[model samples]
Target: MSPKLDRIGSVHLTMRQVARATQNFSPSMKLGEGGFGTVYKAQLQDGQMVAIKRASKENFDSLRSEFRSEIELLAKIEHRNLVKLLGYVDKGNERLIITEYVPNGTLREHLDGIHGNYLDFSQRLEISIDIAHGLTYLHSYAGNARFCSAFGKCSNGEAMDLVDPQMREDVDEKIFKKMLNLSFQCAAPTRADRPEMQAVGEQLWAIRMKYLQLGREE
Candidate 1:
C-alpha cells in the first residue's frame, strides 16, 4: 500500500485495470515465476514501467496472509538498490504487489553473462559494496534481523576455487582474499561471532578505497 491508501498507502487497483495492462495475464508478459507466484512486466497507461508480483492461486488463504506483511514491509523500504513499491490489487482473491521496474537483470545474470557483459573485478567489487550498503540499510531500518545470522553458509572453498572464473583477468588476489575473509567472518556459525552489518559496510568501503588506490598507482 502507498501509506496513503489505508495506513498501507498503496493504491487500490481494480482487477480489470491490471488485466488490461497485462493482456489478461498473458504468458508473454511473464518475467519469472517463484515460490510465491509469477512476476509480470508491464507498461501502465500512464507510460510507467512496473513489475507486478501476483500471488499463487494454489494456496490463496495462506499466501494472502503471508504476503500481507511483505507488502507492508516492502512499502517502507526507500533505498535505491531496493525496488520501490507502487500500488497493489486486493480485489477478490487476486493479490498483487506492483513495484517500479529495474531494467537490469539480476546480479546472478550478470555474473553468468546471461544479460550483460561479464563483470570485471572492479565491477564485481563495486557491486559487492553496493550489496553491503543495501544490507546495512535493511538492517538499520528493519531493526529485527533474525536471518542476518544465516549468512554463515558461505564459503571460500579452496584458495582459487572461490574466485569467479569470469574475473580471472583482472582479479586482485589480496583484495579478493580480504573480501572472502570478511564474508567468512559474517557467516560464522555463532551469532555472537558475526560482525554487525554496519561494520561490514565500513570494511567493504575501506576495501573498495584500497582497490581504487591500487588502480591509481597502476
Candidate 2:
C-alpha cells in the first residue's frame, strides 16, 4: 500500500475483484459520470454496496496526483453530509475510488423530480442548513487553506441566486435571508472576515429551528 493509502487505512482491492463486482463495468451498473470519471454501483463479496469511481484512461496519468491528494484529504475528514471513502484501487492504468452507496440519490436529482420525490419548503431548508454545517466543519477543522477552492466559489456574491426555482415559492423569506447573509459572510474577500464553521453551523441551525417553530404555530 502507498503511504497515503496506509495513512487513510483504506482497503485495497485488486482489479479482478473490482471487475467481478462491477460485471466488467456493465452498462446497467453505471451510475453517473463526472470530471473524475465514471461511477458504478458494485456489490462486494461481503454484500456491502459501494459506489466505485473509475478514472478515464485518457485522464488517468494526469489525475493520479489529484486522486492521491483527494484520498489523503478525504481520509482525514468525516462529516454527515460528506460521502465516506471506503477504499481505492491503483493498478497499471486503472485508478478507482470506492465510497459508501447513497441509495437516496443526489440532492439535484431529487429537486429535478428524477425519483418522483420533491422536497417541501421545510425539507429544503433542512438540507440547506445541513450543507452549511458540513461547510462549517470543513472550514473549521481542516484549516482555511485546505478549503480555499470552496471558499473561492462563494466569493462571487451570487450565492442566493443559486437557489432552486422549485424552492422559490412558499419559502420563509426571513430564514432565507439569514441563510443568504451567512453565505455572503462565508464568501468574504478576506479569510479573516469569515466566521468559523462552528458559528456558521449554529446560525444555520437557529434559522432552521425558527422556521420550524413558526410552522408549529401556524
Candidate 3:
C-alpha cells in the first residue's frame, strides 16, 4: 500500500531502516543522482515507497551543510506540486533525506520526448499554471523567490513553430498562441508593459476554462 504521505511529518529514520528499504543501497534501485546525493527507490517496512538521497561523505562539512539546508527548506513546504519530505537519517557518517516518490520522472524528460508521447496543448497549459502557482507560493510564502522565462521567439508570433511535431495534431494552435502570448506579456522587457500579477492570474483562468471546453469537445 502507498504511504499516507499527507498525514505524515518529518520523522527520524534509522540508518538500518533506510539501508534495508533501499536493498542495501542497490544501484538497480537508484532513481537519479544530483548535487546532494544519489537518490534510490526505497520501500519502507510499512509498504510506503520513497526516494532516499544518501549524502556523499567525501566532503563531509560541505555536503552536510547543504543537506541540512535542503531539509530545512523542504520540511517547511506543504504543497501538492512540491515533493514532501518524509524523514531523514543523520548519524555517524550517514546523512540522508527521504521524500515522497514521484515516478513520472522530470519535466525535462517529458519535454525532450523521453516519455511515451509529447504532451498536448491542454496538458502543457495545465502544467504551466501548476508551476506558476507553485512558484507563486514559494515566492510569497517560502521566502525564496526564483523564476525564469524564455519568451523572445515565442512572443514573435512563431509559437506554433515551436510545438513538438509529434504532437502537433494533439495541440490546439489557438490555445498554444494564447499561452505563449501570455508568457511574453508576463516577461515584457519593460515593467510597464507587463500585466499586473492579478491580471495574469485572471488571464490564466480564462485560458484554463477554454482548455476545459476544448477537452470536452474532443
Best by TM-score: 2
lDDT of 2 by residue, 1-218 (tens): 32344334455678888998999999999989998899999988888789999998889879877777667676777789877787887777888888888988878898988899788999999999999999887766555445554445445654445567887466665676677678778867578998999999999899989999989987
lDDT of each: 0.75, 0.79, 0.75
For model 1, residues 101-124, the per-residue Cα lDDT tens digits are 888866778899996589999999
Q: Is candidate 1 or candidate 2 better by lDDT?
A: 2
Query: Which ranges of candidate 1 are over 4 A from the true structure?
Result: 1-12, 144-218
- For candidate 3, list the clashing residue pairs, or say none: none
TM-score of each: 0.57, 0.60, 0.55
- What's the CA error at residue 104 for candidate 3, in Å? 2.5
lDDT of 3: 0.75
Residue 64 displacement in candidate 2 (angstroms): 2.5
Can you write out model 3's per-residue Cα lDDT over 1-218, one digit (the tens) per residue?
A: 11223345544567777778989999999988788778999988878788988877675677666665555656767788877787777677877878889989878888878988898889999999999988877654543311121344565666677787887367787988898778767765567998999999999999999999999998
Residue 41's C-alpha lDDT in candidate 1?
A: 85
Give the candidate order by descending TM-score: 2, 1, 3
Q: Model 2 segments beyond 4 Å from truth?
A: 1-10, 139-218
TM-score, model 2 to reference = 0.60
TM-score of 3: 0.55
